[model samples]
Target: MNRRESLKDPDDLEFFDRIQKLHLSLDQEFLNQFQRSLPLNEVLIDRWERASRLGFGDQTSIYDSSLVLGNVQVGKSCWIGPFTVLDGSGGLSIGDHCTISAGVHIYSHDNVIQTLSSGRFPIDRNPTTIGRNVYIAPNVVIAKGVNIGDCCVVGVGSFVNKSFDSNKILVGQPAKCIGEVIVTDSSIDFKYF
Candidate 1:
């Protein structure tokens, strides 16, 4: 079947168009408010404890064991694997069609200086942005203020502390460009060194 034939319904076309343009984010102010606010009186009963608690965008799925905190926002078709910790206390944004593998820890706030300095230095707080069609391998640690561009990949066990341009493949303890990413309408492919 041709691409045009697949879209028999106008609503399907509209939904597809929306997904292509999606960008996800949880802003700082919202995160602060959500963190400070008291919990609602209502308690969940008989419902499965899951990422559905958070207001994720269309077609986003998170593993049952994954933990999402504060004001995290995820775009369409995102897959968050098990044992992942997505800390959005500072801010966090994940774009469309991205894959975050199991045991990945993404932090928007760190208390390194504050704890080391006996509360003298403040905790570092910044927004972390992951762009569309990105793939983050398992056990990766992404620090605050990192901006990963579209169609990028972070290798397993890498600690990402800096930003990279679109279509780049990153690896190492402190991730560095290892290759490139190729994105098409139908798929995203990587070329590694």
Candidate 2:
């Protein structure tokens, strides 16, 4: 059902909406609990955080909001776009001063391979991690067993397979180094990463 019908529906949508609203309100409660978390009740915040985050704070964001991280630590002053999926199942970490564009998918496992091996089909996913000062464009797919170094840029619509060192601009399928990334007051250069 659409938003309008769902909002007006009485059977289940109403209940769903109520539950969602309550869940959202829990964030405020979480903040309050965090503030009130004493040495004696430090675990309270941790428990609340665990209960609230469904697989690492599934909050799609851009300018940083209430984040949920599971073995994944994101640094300060970064722009993570909406619908950006950062899975730390195998341990994902995002560094400071980065821009994760919209529709970016970073996987930790190779589902297609595991499907061909064992019985685990669609759910068998892997881990992925990204480093600091990175600029990942829209539609970038970072596959498993890959680590992107700091001060790098992944071009739009690129697919990464292997890991790379610092100071590079990656693009294309099975991404290759296009150039370096240089940022200045005048222009952002990709030839000097």
Candidate 3:
């Protein structure tokens, strides 16, 4: 089909015509600013992290224009990418040597189910635990109370809502374990998929 005809679908890339851009205009400067002080901002990010019983050395890497974190633990040499918001509000714990890419939002915190009937969710929390040597890709949303094991690959834009076993690959919407990484000694050409 032609481009105009293709735009008829709701899932069309031309659907930008229907949606208003929220991030079309945003302060790009705050993207680089680190949250390591309280005297400057109204509330301190480090103090909040400390109060939650975390051991993250450089909290600057963790971005939060507005992030609600709970009791979380972070290990050494963990690279939490910029724009990544780890909310332990549900009581999540992250391990060491993990590479959480940009736009990866991990929220252990949630809204109270009791308030759902009243059209208000005050607060809900569930603990999230991620093991070491994990590679969580960009724009991946680790949902409330997800416990990902070590050495697993969370594909880009995947939503992880359940516990993932170690040494596996997960991808797609509401991601699932597709396969495991295999180390082969075959000498093959690079063009083959």
Give every collision pair in model 3: 70-88, 70-89, 90-108, 90-109, 90-126, 92-128
Per lDDT, the best of the predicted structures is 1
lDDT of each: 0.80, 0.67, 0.67
Model 1 superposed RMSD (Cα): 17.3
Error of 1 at 69 (Å): 1.8
Better of 1 and 2 by TM-score: 1
- Candidate 1 residue-wise lDDT at 134: 90
The parts of candidate 2 lying over 4 Å away from their true place are 1-70, 120-127, 183-188
Writing each residue's lDDT as its tens digit, candidate 1 over 77-110 gives 8889767999998999999999999899999999
Give candidate 2's TM-score.
Answer: 0.60
Order of quality (TM-score):
1, 3, 2
Report lDDT (Cα) of residue 45, candidate 1.
17
lDDT of 3 by residue, 9-115 (tens): 66665465433232222223223464323222323244335423445755323433435366666776676655678787677777777888878889886665757
Residue 66 in candidate 1, Cα distance off native in Å: 1.2
Among all windows of ten consecutive residues in candidate 1, which has the lowest summed lDDT? 38-47
Regions of model 3 farther than 4 Å from truth: 1-54, 57-68, 112-115, 119-122, 182-193
lDDT of 2 by residue, 60-113 (tens): 224222233345556666666655676666667777777888788777655575
